[model samples]
Target: MRKLASICLVFLIYFACSVMSAEDRTIYQFTVKDSDGADVSLEKYRGKVVLIVNVASACGLTDSNYKQLKELLDTYHERGLEIAAFPCNQFGGQEPGCDADIKNFIADKYKFDPDLYSKINVNGADAAPLYQFLKKEQGGTLIDAIKWNFTKFLVNREGRVVERFAPTTAPKDIVKYIEKLL
Candidate 1:
């Protein structure tokens, strides 16, 4: 009876550990809204290296970030780099516009092609589930909530969280990490 009990306890512990591992492996299994309010499953990006950025149209770093992000996309797109940009007004109300207006402004002002990004919320109670999971995977300095606009998270092709960049980290600076993963 003592040996049987010990085996059962070992089995239980192993089962619990397996469950935790599975949860960690599927951290990217979430459904978030697209810019048009449509459900977007993160699983579609399972085998692609994704750079998730919280963007804002009116932020101080908007122009430079946009330009550099475009350059990054052009540089690494065929090599499996995907940039997912989420527009958020949570920081100083920088992205205060309706979906169409935001889209239009991104196209007209920055000459950013809509086909190159995904826009959504980065911080708030209504923040997308993907962002929520990302923050939990990589909490920022002094807080879990995103501090401001243009904060970036890097995910490898396997959907594992690789690195998290603050709002100030330029898109160009992220290339080395991307190259290493590729």
Candidate 2:
């Protein structure tokens, strides 16, 4: 009876641990809305190095981040680098426009087109599920809450969040990491 109880305890422990891992949260497990409000499954990006960024059109960092992000995409797209830009207005209400306005702003002003997702709250109670998972996987420098626009998360081809970058981290600075993963 003692041995049977011990085995049962061990099994319970293993099961608990597995459950605590959010069922192995992978990027492929999420489906998010795009700029057009269409359901897009992240599974489509499986096997590609993905850079997930919480973006804003009116942020101070917008200009440089957009330009450099475009450069990175132009350079490594064929090599399996995919940038998933999620517009969020959680910081200072920087991204206040509707989806179409945001898209047109980026393309016309920055001369760059991105895989734009629907505007989402990247922090607080109403945070998107994908952002919640990302914060859980890699809480940033001081807090899990994203500090500002352009906070980036790097996910490898295996759908694992490998690194988190602060909003201030330039897109160019992340090239080496992307190259290594690719």
Candidate 3:
């Protein structure tokens, strides 16, 4: 009947659109809140090599990782390298603090200022959609679940998640990859 035909056409269109969207999805499509609670579109980092890291203030890896991250930012920030740090408390309650407290902690301990985002859950049912997309793009050896804090996702200029580094991977160890993308 005419009604059946119309419904079938609608379904077809919906299916086609979903397929297209999946193909076109990228990091640029996400907008996340910063430490100050302002929404920041990832699109702003387009055309830049971005290192997206889930950070923690009290984690054991904090010192060395933040130190090396500062060095990397200082060295390559002008060369189109951006480090986007997202604070996550999903691991061992390491990042337990308000945004202001976390910011102050980073400043006092690391003496470094990073593009800090709001605290978010990186795993489980409440994981941020941005983290979900990154995990889907490059799940690494442990699959979609993020193993620990400081897990980093390297996004190329095109906003594709090209690499996933473990929590223990030093920021300095990623310079070669960044250089290649730059």
Candidate 4:
């Protein structure tokens, strides 16, 4: 009876640990809206290194970041680097336009087109599930809340969030890491 109880206890412990460590969803499991409000399945990017960024049109870091992002995309896009840009107005209302306006603004200003998604809240109760997943995967300085626009998450080809970058981290600075993943 003692040995049987010990075995049962060990099984329970193992079951609890496995349940606790299991992930409910992966990056590829999410389906987000694009600038056109169409459902875009992240599974399309499963085999590529993905760089997910919370973007804004009027943020102070917008110009530099956009330029560098354009450069990075132009350089490595054909080499398996996929940039997923999600516009957000959660930071200072910097991105107050509707989807069409935001799309036009990006086109006129940057002349660079990325896989831009629909505007989303990166913080607070209404934050998008994708952002929530990302924050949970790699908690920021504030843990699960995006501090500002341009905060980036680097995802491996396997759809796991591998690294988190602060809003101030430049796209050029992230090139080495992306290269290593590629």
Residues 18-90 of candidate 3: C-alpha lDDT, one tens digit per residue: 7865447689989999999999999999899999999998899988999999999999999999999999998
- TM-scores of all predicted structures: 0.81, 0.88, 0.91, 0.87
Off by over 4 Å in 1: 1-18, 114-121
Q: Is candidate 3 or candidate 4 better by lDDT?
A: 3
Q: Candidate 4 on 1-182: residue-level lDDT in tens?
A: 99999999999999876685424346987999999999999999988999999999999999999999999999999999989999999889999999999999888989989999999988888999999889988998856689999999999888889999999999999988999999
Against the reference, the lDDT scores of all candidates come to 0.80, 0.92, 0.92, 0.91
> Can you write out model 1's per-residue Cα lDDT over 1-182, one digit (the tens) per residue?
99999999999999976687633654366766666777777787877888888888899999989999888888888888888877877888898887777778877987776333345666688787778878988888889898888888898988888789998999899999999877
Whole-model lDDT, model 2: 0.92
Best-performing candidate as measured by TM-score: 3
Clashes of 2: 0
TM-score of 1: 0.81
The 10 consecutive residues of candidate 2 with the worst lDDT sum are 16-25
lDDT score for candidate 4 against the true structure:
0.91
Residue lDDT tens for model 2, 1-182 = 99999999999999976786643678998999999999999998989999999999988999999999999999999999999999998888899999999999989998887789999998899999999999989997767898889999999988999999998899999999999999
